[model samples]
Target: MTNAPFVVMKAVAKRWNGQLGVEDISLDIDEGSFVALLGPSGCGKSTSLRLLAGLEIPDEGQILIDGRDVTTSAASDRNLSMVFQSYALFPHLSVAENVIFGLKVRRVPRAERAKKMKRALQITGLEGLEHRKPGELSGGQRQRVALARAIVAGQRLCLMDEPLSNLDAKLRNSVRKDIKKLQRDLGITVIYVTHDQTEAMSMADKVVLMKDGRIQQVGTPDDLYNRPANTFVAEFVGAPPMALIQSSVLGGFDASLTLGLRAEHVSIVSKGEGQLSCTVSEAEFLGSETLIGLSHEGTVGLSVLQPGLALLDEGTTVDIAFDAANLHKFNQEGDRMSEV
Candidate 1:
């Protein structure tokens, strides 16, 4: 609506020693949107961030910040702040010093810097811990310091590369919510990069799924999960991912396709048309839910999620059903296809 993101990348590409780092790609990230670059390691997601941050110059094409060419601009001139996965705080500095490090480097007035430092600490829930060193705080607390440092810099755009990777599962989940809330309250444009699909789905307003140096798809989380553009997305997203039947059993039919259904969508419904018979192979209890692995006619394997505990034995036969509307069809080349 309003001139989307004030950032743009046009025909961007990067290569190193004849190996592609990122292929020609263009994107428009509107202001105040939390856009996540989601992909596996070595998938060019990080490379895209470097280019945007001016940490790496593009091999070709240009970058525009609010319609101004900044392709050749120095990293310092980019007016952006970044938080790395490592929580790269100066080891000897206390939390307060770390948060104001950027301001000091830019020679911001002492009084202004102090005011912003207090604000950053309060915003990140680090006010009382400002004097503590990174070594003295928990991993979650350390990451919050890094976030405060980025915000204190007063950059309109913030780039984060796996900021929660250092925490354990419980801490990761807790910090993820905190970060999302912070982004909302600040209303700052953020480009977050991570390989964890859960993080992307939970936080991003727009998710950019990447693979092998190219963008696979860019859409809202619901768009990617319910309407993947290809098999790769279906297999990569969702917890436990979508259960895929490698080849359809409808003999002589278009067996050159794979069927995609999320674990929660594939259920043991009452017998119905298009139902695929499967035998239970294993069941796992995950406290809030149960994961049941199934195989159809002893060949096609799949997994499903059911609320509460599963009561079936390993060999019990069950009809695994899915709503055709929730199904995604992919061709052998991994491209998605719409049913006729």
Candidate 2:
């Protein structure tokens, strides 16, 4: 990482017709750092990436790369690379040709283009498949081809818009690891856009979460998970999602307050031996752990994670407890009140 910022977005805003695409978005990307723009569909994450790519011009604010203003510059003039979800490769071109297309367009000598092509293919594990066309490759392999295209450019910044959206679960995980390793090895800055929290949390050094064209919070994965800025972040950044309860139901808390607890933090104990009592409403076997859903007094519903096949049947009563130290408090406005 570098001390000076490599990319800066100052209050950038984009609108389509009468509607806003992204509003007042600002960010500073450190050199060699991987940042993720995360949010649901239509939440402006992709739009933000396009803005940085110069595919969409911002109606307000400015974008600077390496301290150079490129707000209104062409995408090619920005000296950045982009990998799309569609793996936009020339169907008729061989893998090697596709990877070296940028160098060819830039009129690099044949020897220089070949050197870059070879290096890109080797880095992406596509050395043996260099002769194959996009049609002959698997989904993961094609994605690698697209990555090779980006890496061959040797740019300081790379913008990825849901690059793994087309891969299956198993392939997605494998390629995710490969991409992270490649980024570290190359020491290039990346801004990836994704709706999947798992991908964002696992890969990014920093996450910029968005909602309705505006930023909700920006933080590390642990920071977003442990200390969400508001209820929206608390509910969006988790896997099974955090369970929110009315504070009044837990005793000695005001009715206007809410409590947030993670499934892993809630432990099941014998009846009368825990802080709260509930009846099991549903149980799911998730290979290494059991997800037990509990309904309390026909009002509050919560999920708890129990290790390795603790099969409690539906309708069975179990007490649940969590340390006060793990509790998160929120006021009526949905903003974080305190970390208990």
Q: Give the per-residue lDDT digits (tens) of candidate 2, residues 1-340.
A: 6476899999999988979899999998889999999999999999999999999899999999999999999999999999999999999999998999888989989998888888888889998998899999999999999999999899989999999999999999999998999899999999999999999999999999999999999999999999999888988988678788888788888889888888999998777899988888899999899999888752344789989998888999888889977878889998899653
Tell me model 1's lDDT, rounded to 2 decimals. Answer: 0.87
TM-score of each: 0.93, 0.96
Which segments of model 2 are wrong by more than 4 Å? 297-301, 338-340
Clashing pairs in 1: 4-30, 5-29, 5-30, 5-31
| Pairs in clash, predicted candidate 2 | none
List all candidate RMSDs to the true structure.
Answer: 2.2, 1.7
Alpha carbon lDDT at 123, candidate 2:
87
RMSD of 1: 2.2
lDDT of 1 by residue, 149-262 (tens): 988888889999999888999999999998899889998999999999999999999999999999999999999988888978887887777767655563433778776777
